[model samples]
Target: MVRTPQPGTHSSTDHDPDTPQYEAGAGGWGSLRGVARIFAEARSSPEALRILAGQNKPKGMMCTSCAWAKPAKPHTFEFCENGAKATLWELDQRRADAEFWQSHTLSELRRLHDHDLEKAGRLTDPLRYDPESDRYLPVSWDEAYDEIGRELRALDPTEAVFYSCGHAGLEAAFLFALFARAMGHQNLPQSSNMCHETTSVNLLKYLGSPVGTCTLEDFDHCDAIFFFGQNTGSSSPRFLHVLKDVVDRGGRIVTFNPLRERGLVEFVDPQNLSQMATGRSTPISEEYYQVRPGGDVAVMAGLMKCVLAAEDAGPGTVLDHDFIATETTGYAEAEAAVRAMDWADIEHHSGLTREMIEQAGRIYLSSNRVIGIYGMGLTQHVNGWLNLGMLCNLLLMRGNVGKLGAGVSPVRGHSNVQGQRTVGVGEKSAHMPADKLRELFGIEPPTDDGLNAVHACEALLEGRMKALVTLGGNLVRALPDRTRMEAAWPRLRLTVNIATKPNRSHLVPGQVAYLLPCLGRTDRDVQETGAQAVSMEDSLSNIYGSIGPAKPPGDNVRSEVAIVAGIAKATLPRNPNLRWDDWTADYGRIRDLIAEMFPDDFADFNARMFQPGGFYRGNSARDRVWKTESGRAEFTTPTTLTALGETPDGQDVMTLITLRSNDQFNTTIYGFSDRLRGLEGDRDILLINRDEMSRLGLDEGQPVSLVCAIDDGHERRVDDLKVTPYDIPAGCVGGYYPELNPLVPLGYHERNSQTPAYRGTPVRVVP
Candidate 1:
């Protein structure tokens, strides 16, 4: 959750150009040093430290936000910039109780910006808004749960939706799924559907797996890496250090991206003493290729053709000829298509030269083992599934799958975002078979197909969805079509949010709205059994236990697990098969159930997760042990060469890509400034190309409204956007999502994954 403080309640500065670079008596940089001091003081303060240490299940447990705790070793800096943001955000000293909500009406709170609303701080109790009084009144835990149960019981289960964000713990998610199933509803919308659903959906189809095959530590063992649209330095700094080691050891990196971000070219590793002290930066990419917005298929096909040619020539080549023939299918036809294409045409469409393409192939050919890394940049395209398949083809051609250092790695955002889906938090349960969820849970779960994120928004707009229970997410703001959502939010019968801090979602409340606050990841989860530990799955499908340090907000406030358990108990009192025994008492039982559900992977979840470092779920895809019917990995061929789109005549079409700033994560707005882009204190600025700006007769800072060019005839427009001309690519413009979400129609999504096409939406930028 975003924790933007209110005016004067917390310390912050305007975009002052004349601020000092360094503060007197401080040992480091200006605002950073000041922030460091405050963080230290917060750690040392008696009450704060008591809340952090005593409330901790295992007293003195380290924070879960970052790698700050000393692991029996000494370190210079205690936290990273983003880690500090997470720590401060969780440990903020503000409180929003019944009285606070009593004074602020829902309509009045709507007038407040997202930043100011978060300033009200952690919710101290569960609240239900009274439309007559125009304020949210405090409700007891029993009453709150009972009211939600009543609503669920009253409605046709299919009309209600249970939406969740990535931050929810595994136990909470499991319990939510159970409750939803008990009620016979399947409208589970999660954060993963927006981000990595393409990778998950396609990988499951191609490799019979939904996760990355390679681990983070495998970057050290790679000889070459093909980074498909991932900005390691800016997006995930830890990847930067790994890339540095790869570069230092004469490893080659070939980047395939439209925008040539500086972070990819040269990044100064703060972990390196010599580099940081001398301000020397390491070069990450040996060669870079800027692929066209929707031309990833051609770029990958071209690379595959090179490997195929080498294999046909002789035995000594990058690809193992026997393995290609025996293991892979469709190589002949794929090669024929690749060979049929002209180099000049490939270069023309991809916006990359043949020389660069050959250089990338050479990098792959020279390396004994390779790892392919990608992010949303690769998965947000119209042909995202085909792009994923293309990457899989490249890996399969060289027998990269199941190798020690060579595999596919997709860097995921939103901590525990992957976990939510792993534990049956999807529209359809992962634990469910064809008929029902009866085999696993002993009761028939919903057989009705569930609504994903996109479907949920459309359902709300069409007034098909009556009730919404957001476990944790800024749904309206995080989703597209914000303007339509603003109007649609009031149509719901009940809107319940189980959140940590205030965001734009809370502003759009229903007639009988409730804000059920819960504990953060860094806070202790206490229950009758004792200090409880919540489990989470990492990006690499590794499940681990997170024992928070700080105390939960108040006595009235509860852990997410407790809230779900309470709701379940209220809703399922008559069911004999149901068990709420360990629901709120402990989280270990939930882990046991998860282990039961996935015996092959998590055989002993309780023992394995208790280790200092987490354990990994053995990825069969890494070993080429496909879980498909054939028991072998299948080669998928693309039906279409490129993504087909209808561009209106004289519209001057371009791909509108949505992005997150270096300072933010998901939809959580931590800071207004994007320091890397050289924009300070401005979230409203769009990064446009200078050359394109000149050709279009536009200035550097021109405010423009963007309208999406959809073939569906749905009107979507985001007006009053500030455009800043920069080093972006021609026929491409970038803007922050959720903010510019008003321009994207909810139905404008990828074909297979159904994930919103935020990256490659066809739109025209007018002056």
Candidate 2:
């Protein structure tokens, strides 16, 4: 039974008595602990120190962890806690050489968790899966490419899928998407499809462009910052300083999230020695509202409704009438929709009292310059697309767009994920600017739309998709529906992973599974043009060059560009028109091609990137230039809030929001401890509200089974999870992912964006 979005479902959290909470704010001593862990992992190697010194500097390596833009000035320690871990993890001296692989069998390795697999260290060579022995044996690059080319040529392009993670270098991702396009297939789906796809989808629908309208500079000028379902501190630690600066300048922040994130409550600057020494912390959020899971759309509605009510009292009281009339469309319809929403329904859906909603509205009304910030918490929902659309509507109502300290901001994860999308990685259904590809490549791109992650999973399971080639991500591990995706893996005829560290995905055998290890972001990527650099686009759309100081983890490790080009050069017709060799030889030539493709944005791409921090790619929305269909910012008038909820069925049903541990980034885990969250040693614990525990006849440390309530006609269950009392919204339960990913259904995604509802999954806890 696929459940409809409704009110009975509620999100919750939990905590344990033994593990003391991380109340000492972000950074400070916490970062020192992270550095210590990294030092231990790298064994205090000089190469590790060199990589650390180069991190986040003007000419330093990009932190492969998050997409937070670099600050104008470099502090003595520029990297954050997680950034330290990522740096050390990338520079890890451990090697899973041929000897290591020879010692471990697939059956034995499969027992290890995802983190253990990564801890096995960098793959030393290309590995081919041998089913008879059930182990991945070493294979030469030439043999791997030859086999991949033969397989690619044999299969119809439509039957194959190209998947990439955010960390793949710009040139590599460009060639990756181009390879798909040139092969006459639109089956290229990257990380965004499963995470921030809603941000792009709704932003594109409203403002013509999907990129953020404001830069980090706006953080300095904003009078007030409104947070919706985002914990900037743990996710993007660099942004914590921006929040602190906002408060230091007398700016107020309002947060709406189910869980009470430490960063939103208070923060201690790691750089401020006095404060660090004194143990004093700076409080961040002026007001915090524990909204229910999946309630972002309703909260936005309530806020807009309050704005409209104030508008009704005085024609232009809260609404920016001048800006509304001049810069937006469908205002009347959207206004009516807001007016039509009942106050009781708003209260019910938003999990907030009318007074609270009005209070938040008053703050918005008083602010001269306001900013809205959100993350996967808002976007990974059944109605995530509407959630973003409503956010855009709320911001536009106050004329928040195109001004200092005011805009709709989606804090994307991964360093270069946005760059991957910018370089045209997407299903042909939308997002990809295909005309540019045809014009630049002089090849006919596939006209028909292709499959995204979820759709591709279905295609693979249903025998429609036969082959899979991934550039950087652990596709099987990163995606939803572990039960089905596990089943879908064997259905593929061939699977190729261009990676650095081996993961569980490699162990999931295909008829032909090949692991081609590539140089990581921490490694210096040298090509025929001497030591080379790769360009990355930050969350703020800042395009910059990143050059690392360390050598490749293994001699067999190749550059991403080389691997991508090698596969393409071997697979395609002899001397194809696209010329894979030229781009592979000189990345500058690749930039030249990109400049030709995205002339307005990437013009003089190579020369501009030579500068310390690259320039902004420029968003038309920033200048009130709407690229939308109506030539103005469009407004969507949704009829009702999402009906996504589940009722207690004999057993109490809780809205389960799966989150990453502080020790993890995406699927990469540094260790078991989540120091920021007071969690350690294990990832199997469930977080439930203390008050809700009492109401539901549950207690701290009580073991229970989590069963997917929205059956989707599938059996998804994780048994014997010990519940911990946590500081979160009542009626919601929390668990770490991808442990809880099996609870999420493939069909459970926003219609507009197709982002899996990881934040609003319905599950019942049974004794």
* Number of the top-ranking candidate, with lDDT as the measure: 2
Q: TM-score of every model?
A: 0.90, 0.96
- Kindly provide the TM-score of model 1 when superposed on the true structure, using C-alpha atoms: 0.90
> In model 1, where is the ten-residue run with the lowest total lDDT?
1-10
Q: Would you give me the overall lDDT of model 2?
A: 0.82
Count of backbone clashes for each model? 1, 16
Which residue runs does candidate 2 get wrong by more than 4 Å? 1-20, 429-439, 643-651
The candidate that wins on TM-score is 2
Ten-residue segment with the worst summed lDDT in candidate 2? 1-10
lDDT of each: 0.70, 0.82
lDDT of 2 by residue, 409-481 (tens): 8898989999988887888634446677656666777889888888898898789998899988877777888
Residue pairs with colliding backbones in model 1 are 402-622
